[model samples]
Target: MSLDDKPDNTAKPHDRLAEALASDMAAVDALIAERMASENAPRIPEVTAHLVGAGGKRLRPMLTVAAARLCGYEGSLHHNLAAAVEFIHTATLLHDDVVDESKQRRGRPTANLLWDNKSSVLVGDYLFARSFQLMTDTDNLRVLSILSNASAVITEGEVLQLSAAEDLNTTEDTYYKVVRGKTAALFSAATEAGAVLAGAPEDQIAALHDYGESLGIAFQVVDDLLDYLSDAETMGKNVGDDFRERKLTLPLIKALAKADADARAFWTRTIDKGDQREGDLEHAMELLHATGALEETRAAALEWADRGRERLKVLPESELRQMLDDLADYVVARLR
Candidate 1:
């Protein structure tokens, strides 16, 4: 079944997703707290906690725990690994806010907002170090390799995005390459580490990695879509933020793919150079609608989610495994 097949909670269907997550995420909390407590510098602890406690879906660590359960893991190392995954995810968000000059996250003031940029940068480094230490403590070379390589790819992806911004020449291939590196890399690493920790068979491990990678790409695609379709109150950020920042995301990329001469002039003047003005956003939206680019972007996310669910078929039937599939769907269902 597809991840989109999740039970609708309020209408005629009841979902037991929370019950499945509760089975494993309680220990994940302690692990996260323990990892966050080691900021030896007094300022370090407070600042990191602000970002750490900002609250997210905890999807990466959840992937670790879910993969472990699907693989029949019964040991406690999943706890430490889960924390490691969380630390990495939080560190990225901390650094991302700084890079994006973002003042808010998860509907609250960002660490970079509450504290100075320097504090956010240093605390992010601290979290990175702590993640490395925790992963090393597990003494699993494969796990370390997976996370470390993903880190490298994530940095490369960020750099790629930096370079791609405002470049109207960016293609769908380039967009996928960037997202795969920035987002999918981490998801793959988390699930692969979970399976490796559990001693899952090689094929199953590969399948889990594919599952996470697909889910991650699908999740990011939907996020990019929401920027155009939702309000800041619901999306937890400003609409047209990407356009303001001159960041070329999937919708923009698709719109660019079909830009006519006049539309091209509009984009090159406003979007590429960040020379936004009255009616610029609306005009851009018109181009995207006319070209059907928004629909195409959403379709791409749906295709990735379908691939993710298909990969899950490699795993045996179980509630936890089924929940993972549903969670994948939930990530992209926002687009629909």
Candidate 2:
């Protein structure tokens, strides 16, 4: 099923939080639309609107707004920061689609596939520049520092992932580094910047940062797991797309680590050499199951989710905190 197929009225943790913060989110939506506009270049807004209009969870920006609210931020500047966070995320998606040669996002055609790669890449750059302009409006140096560092780390992570792709020697430690860079960096920044803007105490700021980091790691682990187990309709892309792309995600990496002679040869032929046959994906899934890699990966995701929940305890107890706690559980719930 597509994201739209998910039941709207269901009491998902994110839905509950969004409902609670409805007014603030509406402000954020307005700010995003206003900021994404361009006078001279119609193509910029057109490309951005296509991706932004495709319904997303808007989880990162929500984290920013929620963190600010949790820390008693009463001003409207968080809305600007939240919109900036979203622009950064959407910009990354546009760049990633071109890099991955992706055909679909959110069950719709990717910006790169629908337009040209040049348009996607240039538009992504424009969004990145726009995001910086928005963040500067906050006039908080710390917030700017956190976001700039995250942008740099994300680019570094993508480059590292490019080097590690299909390399069988990629260890779990290396995998964590990549995840922390590419995915967790923005998550931690979103929360940390909000707290900084709120003038939160150092301990509270640290707690929110840790919470976002752990949650982001768990989120990516579950995504990697789903790419193997979920169907195209549910995942918004074909199952085993990672395998076809020669990405050495957790399950496949674990399976390869334990592969005997025959298994190693199979991985080498399909992943390293990219000489996939008809039943290669099925056989790869069988190996993941037989080697207990899938279970192991699930366990890791659960551990990270628990880590995120524990970090939330440092914040004051409130309904928002509970929602954040539930969000951590919901991230890995798909594995069950």
Candidate 3:
């Protein structure tokens, strides 16, 4: 199924935006298809098509289009800009699956698993190059700079995540740093680039950037929470994947912060030592509850969602703005 075909509540905030932006989204899709094509290397398009065809909300690109429209832009360049944002996002996903050794993505086998790691990496590189080309086509220096810096920050975040992996000493501050670099940077850049493309005022651009940042952070936190609480059908991957992977997500970090001696030992054996076994995941969940980490994490997500909503106040009061306002709550609605 395509992004629009994914079964979801039509009344949901994102769905509303999707319906409103249908024409623009189609144009963006056409741009994506045109740019991802390769006559020299067939494998580049093949691997890219595999993942791009897989269902996703296309939320990052949508944010770009939405930002531009909200800024009163009536031009077609936002389509190229949105497509560039998607290429950046898709490139990261391809690289991430390899780094995580993930077998599944968007409820299907990952590009790496279906083909090979080398193909995935090289194709991802091709996509990155394509994204740069798309950005350059806009001829907006500020937009180009914002997107390029976001790409660098994303890479830096992934490296930081690798360095911090399995270390029980990872703090909440480090967790935010990782989230901002790996996830929020693209989100903020997507919106900021759109606003820049539309020649939006500086204050409005800053507000959109802040809104995207908070929304992205909240989205990541909730995703981590769902790794423990959601089913495979809901999450597209098995529950407790992060626990099995020994990744120090927000919930785990919060749990570790309040760990007692025995709890610390359990974490050490299961996480630090990478000696996870059956029942360990369940015990980890129990510890999360015992430490109130899950609750704390939930509250944090809500707070970020609220912050994102607040940032939208600076934008004009329109249907798109209301959808964005509602989207902040909708992002965390699953927790409810």
Over the full model, what C-alpha lDDT does candidate 1 score relative to the true structure? 0.84
Cα lDDT, model 2, residue 142: 93
Q: Which sections of candidate 3 miss by over 4 Å?
A: 1-10
TM-score of 1: 0.93
For candidate 1, write residues 1-336 as lDDT tens digits.
223344444421113454455646778887777767753578887886776676676778878878987898888888788888888888888899899898888888888888889988888898888889888988898899999999999988988988888898988888888999889999999999999999999999999999999999998899898888888778877788787778789999998888889999999999777788999988888898899999999999999999999999999997667677777777776777
lDDT of 1 at 299: 96
Candidate 2 residues 1-336, lDDT tens each?
112233344599999778777888899999999989999999999999998899698899999999998998989999999999999999999999999888888888999999999999999999999999999999999999999999999999899999999898898988988999999999999999999999999999999999999999999999999999999778767899899999989998899889999999999999999999999999999999999999999999999999999999999997788888999999999887
Better of 1 and 3 by TM-score: 3
Assess every candidate by TM-score: 0.93, 0.96, 0.96
The TM-score between candidate 2 and the true structure equals 0.96
What RMSD does model 3 have? 3.2
User: Candidate 2 overall Cα lDDT vs. reference?
Assistant: 0.92
* Residues 1-336, model 3: lDDT tens digits: 122343344588888788878889999999999999999999888898898898589999999999998898888999999999999999999999999888988878999999999998999999999999999999999999999999999999999999999999999999999999999999999998999999999999999999999999999999999898999877777889898888999999999999999999999999999998888988998999999999999999999999999989999897788778888999999997
